[model samples]
Target chain A: MNGYAGKILRVNLTTGTFTKEPTPADVARDFIGGRGFGIYFLLKEVPKGADPLGPENKLIISSGPISGMMIPGGGKCDWTTKAPLTGGYAGASMGGHFTAEMRYAGLDSIILEGISPKPVYLFIDNDRIELRDASGLWGKATFEVEKQFKEKLGEEYQIATIGPGGENMVSYACINHDYGRQAGRGGVGAVMGSKKVKAIVLHGTKSIPVADMQAYRKAGMALYKACKDAEGLKEWIRYGTTTVVDWCNQVGALPTRNFSAGSFEGAEGIYGKTMREKIVITDKGCFGCPSPCGKYSRSKKYNSYVEGPEYETIGLMGSNLGIDDIEVVAQANLLCDDLGIDTISAGNSIGWAMECYQKGIFTKKDTDGLDLKFGNVEAIFTLIGKIARKEGFGVLLGEGVKRASKKIGQGTEKFAIHVKGMEQSAYATHNATAMLLAYMTCDVGAHHNRSWAITYDLQVGRDLVVPEKVARVIWLQNFRPMFDVIGGCRLQWVELSIDRDLYVPALEAITGIHRSWEDLEKVGDRIWNMTRMFWARENDGFGREWDLPPARFYEDAPTTGATKGQITKLEDVNRLLDMYYEQRGWDSNGLPTLETIENLGLEAVVA
Target chain B: MTASIRLSDSLKNLLGSEGLFTIEAGHSVREAIVSLGINPDLVAVVSVGDEMQSKDYLIQEGDTVRLLAVIGGG
Candidate 1:
């Protein structure tokens, strides 16, 4: 098939068996690719109520038609599994050259099933795929393991490896790749670690095909031109997502002190400009991306090189922990990356711990004699290491804030700041209803990627719990993730504000499919509804209550900073949910109605 | 007529102002922004005091307007 590697690689680690199957045409045509393929395989193969870390759980990695092509921002890959973190659905989009390599190696998806008898790594050289001994690499840091793989396999190969966090089965452990980028969130790496596969090394020299090669090339070049000519392109490349640090601070959405406040008092020290001036060493890009957002920096204070203290890290680690120093946040970011943990969740869990300590729920005695105070950089660093190793207080924190808060049980769950089991990402949602709903209904938990409607919230009315706000959130939910569905990054349209219509011709030329934004959005809506069904199918008695944002947002107003005395009313929160459920065609309980299911053609997936 | 305008830190250098400043009334926030020689596209969100306002929002007497630069992603 044109624009496809057209093969799915299946490796049964339990029996050391391997097989290759032709990519199913109907699956590709209907679901599109990448995350779509991931969920399709997940729903069909992974039986309901299967243990997430057991042999029944499968890790499916996929790249879409646009992946590895000469298209701008085409480096995204999706890692979908029965999430060990949330125990529902997990689909993490990873950026770098690895997806391209996987495509070139003649793979549309790589499925890892069952548990291995011994530690091993999957080595793929074009069609040569094997499970090699990985005993020596099992416990190593992700960075060290990646370095070892590149050295041993030659630099042409790409590697995705997990560290102690994954090896020890930390719920938020992530897969590290390209020295910096990661398949972060939902503990996909933990699943890989559970299967006793330390890493996947890939090297492929085969050429990727397109239906209309000449049209594809022309369309791709035009895309690059549009991106190059886009306004603020240079500024976007210079700062990446960090560009928003000052903006978020100004708007009181910086997630300071674990969501108690929106603005950080010392936010100036860690703003984008401060970070660029103080620590940023280079601007990095993913494969074929012109507007690169990855800021590679060297922290002189910490004596470390890290990819980011990106906006999320800045808010979660820097400001949320009461840290205003960019260098210290950078070091903490490096600690999480090297240890194979999701910085968003790690920072969040640590922030919760800091709050708990200050609230007297945990004294120094329970904290291993360390003062776990907010802004105590040393304590943050120590706790990260302990969490990665799953030791002491770290073990409890490693469970993520939701479960940890329940275990602590001194009214700490009120401040845990999560939706479902996943900790809330950077944005402080005190009064931003659109963003609050985005987090509340986000399929994979409290992630912001599925729908970032904070800007829309501010542009409309931050506290308005109206149908328009709900509609905006729903539109974004259907629109933003289509990039991942096609194995491309969303920031080109999101950050650059480039003409999204520019992608139409390119997608058509590459895949021979004529899809408008409406058609693509329909697919997005279908994927979203299907994933929501996955959540309902996985959990018993799951309903509207699971969609509620943390009580802190509704109960407590920030007593300081820009959002001082600002809070969303509990009734307004429920009102927003009521509108959102109505707009989404779901019942008040939040389960997809039978008619809604049949309308989306999702009866079979749920069945 | 006059309206108070608040520029974020990133936009302050362009306008040579700190915090809130009153501006001669123009029909709309866009017009007022143009009168100040600032590009409207540079601002991501506009607020009439605490409530959000579109660029086309008519500026009224005693209105305090706030502007934030566009910057966000997942």
Candidate 2:
């Protein structure tokens, strides 16, 4: 139990009962922890076709061996459940002190199940745990609720809570932690809301036992030292994701005017340089993080503090909506964080609606008299609140762009800009076919984290469709998510050229298990197939049709910028998917073949 | 050739009130920034217009240069 906390905490809100079960060593061996454990539990415990928002659905939160250790960017956690929105696999990664706190509490996973009779919050302080009334906090903003908890229970505890949007079960609701950092995406917070669980207030001081303390400490220190010594480390941190804002703008990757074009004329106002000069009050770090990327900003215009209006928000809320004001983007980010919704999804959905209005698909009456136009900061702000409340026309939008478009059908689905029902993250992949395929094949839909091959696309030809390109994406897909599996940030290795080999020693010392990159990649491959299996089991005809980019990538090329009039041909798109499926040992329909499942030892876990 | 170079707050503090400094490029972009009499650590990225380029990248005439300083991260 050296690598694990040796126990699992199961809380049933409906029965108001809590139980602790010893962590299963066999399960731990098969699925290491964090995202790995989360997926495993989501597969086994949650039945297929179960309603994602019902009492039957359970939220499984777990941390991996590397969490809370001295390892570089060691703090990370996994939020996994059946998605309320997609009704498929949902696994969101959270980074903050909460993961580290789990290790200290001597709990490997916390399984929350059954709907409560009323609003309640789980409070844990070492061995003591209680379900307290959350009556007053039910409708409060995420930040305000967290602040209230910090004050009520002392600042020592770390809390993860949802907002009014979640309480109402908005399809894209997210969980907010440490004021700003979120387990964002896939409606995990909606599941919590439907269960009437408002917050998790946890504090612990017990030292996490390691298999070999000296070796672990040494390996961890080496990683930190290398990251600090990295040539780009200082620079990478200077702006974090925001640093790429100017680069995206230059390279035609910035999503402007709801992805109608690649570059934005007014992008300079929202670039990293401008934010650094105008806002950015302080920098915030996760547990034991050396280079903090959370640009905590104080918007003097709003007289409020928001952790980031990072590149995604900059793209989706700023350039995507034609809003140049940094303060406006920052305020929008703050609103999404407090409302307990995914900022990327919220921003993209709103951007899509704005595009619809601009195209004369809807009139001012259809938008509840708000005009729903780009660059209208006031109107955009109003729509965000209405969506969270599921008020007026906003009720249709809260379901997300995929559903919203179908409801508002005027051939609007052509410009939906989603893959497998999830709104695309900030990157405009109009010409970048590899990145487009990456988004399509990502387990959680169009999220960039699974395989951020944009840099690889730049290094190689952006428009090239080849087996090697598919291989590169597959390799990254297997490799990148291992960071989440181990409960650590990928940036230290991704941004900094620090040797990934450094993590091997840290893993061995922590878990007393010798696992090389080859062994780990196999596990990554297994997890990918297992998640794919979950999708196939849950959704009818979950095949090639589901792994699709929005029609816009093929139909409408950028009318402006570097990628003007350049579209990935439909034949080439199919060819890329073919190569990817073949490389992944899947069939033409993109289903994991029986032979592939057997080879990955996932046959038993699949349908 | 005189090209405008904008310095951030941190770099502004280091390089003084002269926000825009025009310098001649000798060997490479790094050399030009170094020639501007600014600390190397204070400069994180050097850009020509909006394009982010490495220190080894060549800077030419009429390029709107931007020198960003390493501030803080996430």
Candidate 3:
């Protein structure tokens, strides 16, 4: 295997034993790597109906063939497991130097199995791997843990650690790496915590083997050149993801006031330009990235240094909570990062709580003497810590908005703003039918990473429920996630608008396999179907009903903002799902038909 | 009649200017972009002041149009 390290490392915590096996060739050929490998193993190995936070649930962390290579934005890896959040399929893409280090260790995937009797961290320095005593590291914040490890083990080592959120097994806890980057969705970190593993430190010096060195070098150089030549490169590096704040606000897609509105009047205070001028100190890049999207900032007012209050955080924590101060958002971002909780989920959960407070569903008695009002900056800070530590009111929030709303009642579930228990990331899809459909059908709940079609919605008609909109969403879902499968970032092609074909030759040279976009999309389709089946198998009666967005999207129109008086009709939502199911070759109930499964060659795999 | 078009940094780089330019009113955003020798497809968002508009939106006199490059969002 030219592009691969050609090994899989399995560590059993209960037995305190580890083993390495050869990476299977057929699996690589069919599934590629990264997310592809993660799902393949999840379905093949993990038994059905296993408790997500129990011993049976395994965490599959994998890097793709292009990882650690000379390819631009090649630092991405995939973490797949049975989700404690959604209780369905959980796969998150993390970008940093961890995947590169994993490749240098001559490993593709590190599978953590069973539960450790005590807290431990997996330590790997080349071939010398051990389950080190992490009793001292347990319950520590992610930054402190990483700092301690880096100080003790030296700077070359890359460490991924969980904070109190994970230690407490918060449903939306995340694994933090490289200070700020995270495998930041679902409950992969909770599963790690459930297994009592606090962190994984890695350092490797091995050179990755490629199929054709000459061709590989040429393709790699061409990629770098294209990225450099891209018109958007400098601007993308400058603003990172924050550039979209104004655009999202303009388009009525910025999540505001717990998604009650699409735009915030205070949006100007947190726009990309404001972030750049006010807080951004450095433009940070992941491993081998040309156009780095990480905006590292230092908030003088808060006296905090954090990687991002990126667009998602700004939308979810800033506008969505009715707090527009970028500095406050940055502090909140730092708090979430240190606590090892997903900011999107934490902010969303807080937003729901605030909305609940505004509706008089709860009083100061419920909030424990704290004003749980929207834009209550002090309360926002307090709740983040409580959520991580699972203290007081935080206990209810730690369970996530979906579960919390279900428990709270009082018509709160209607405005919980989630799809399948995962909080909707930052996009307010009030009238954007395509983007809304994308959120509804995304494999990992309401995450936008799978398919971001809001621009397409603006390009076409935002409120149109035509088949073209549905088709666009489907095409994007299949095409965009190939980057995660290939173990690289899609921003170069996505943000820079570089020719995606540049990757074809690069992949061919590295993998020694000829795959066109069509071929790769076919594989993506297979993986997509496999994940859909995984969801169906894990949950009872999983179908179209489970895919529905919160009632607020169709029922409540924003009283203010750009999307005021605009709403997606409930019938249009169904129509979009109908077209989506038909195009995907699924039944009306949204289950993969037997013929569709056979067509994708997943008969034995699904069975 | 004239309207001002404010290009983002990326668009400014593409067009090689100070980023602020003048365009004739009554022309569609797509046509204005094409007139400036830039591909209409390259611009992902077009806004006039705080309002997002499609490329087909007719430019109005004294309107300050903002154009942003395609952002395959995170």
- For all predictions in the order shown, the interface RMSD in Å is 9.7, 10.5, 6.2
Give DockQ: model 1: 0.13
DockQ category of candidate 2 = incorrect
Error of 2 at A71 (Å): 1.2
- Give fnat for candidates 1, 2 and onward, in order: 0.18, 0.00, 0.32
- Better lDDT candidate (1, 3): 3
Kindly list the per-residue Cα lDDT of model 3 for residues A67-124, writing each as its tens digit: 9999999999999999999999999999999999999999999999999999999999
Tens digits of per-residue lDDT for model 2, B1-74: 54556664434543455667776643467787678776553455676654555667776766766665532212
Native-referenced TM-scores of chain A, all candidate models: 0.99, 0.99, 0.99
Q: DockQ scores for all the models shown?
A: 0.13, 0.06, 0.23
Ranking the candidates on TM-score from highest down gives 3, 1, 2
TM per candidate comes to: 0.92, 0.92, 0.93
The candidate that achieves the highest TM-score relative to the unseen native structure: 3
Q: Which of 1 and 2 is ahead in lDDT?
A: 1
- Sorted into a CAPRI-style docking class, model 1 comes out as incorrect
Model 1: how far is A390 from its true place, Å?
A: 0.5
- Please, what are the lDDT tens digits per residue for candidate 2 over residues A1-607? 7788788999999999999999899878888998899889888888878899998899999999888888878889999999877778889999989988877887888999999999999988989989999998989999889888888888889999999889999999999999888999889999999999999999888876789999988998998898877645555566777887766776677888888888899988898878977898877889999888889898899998899988888889899999898999999999999998888888889989999999999888899998887899998899889888889977887998999999889999989878878888888888888888988899988888888766556656789998988998899888888888988998777656467899999999999998998899989999998899889888998899988888888889898886789788888889999999999999999988899999988866765
Where is the poorest 10-residue window by lDDT in model 1 chain A? A229-238
lDDT of each: 0.88, 0.84, 0.91
Give the winner by TM-score: 1 or 3: 3
What RMSD does model 1 have? 5.9
lDDT of 3 at B73: 81
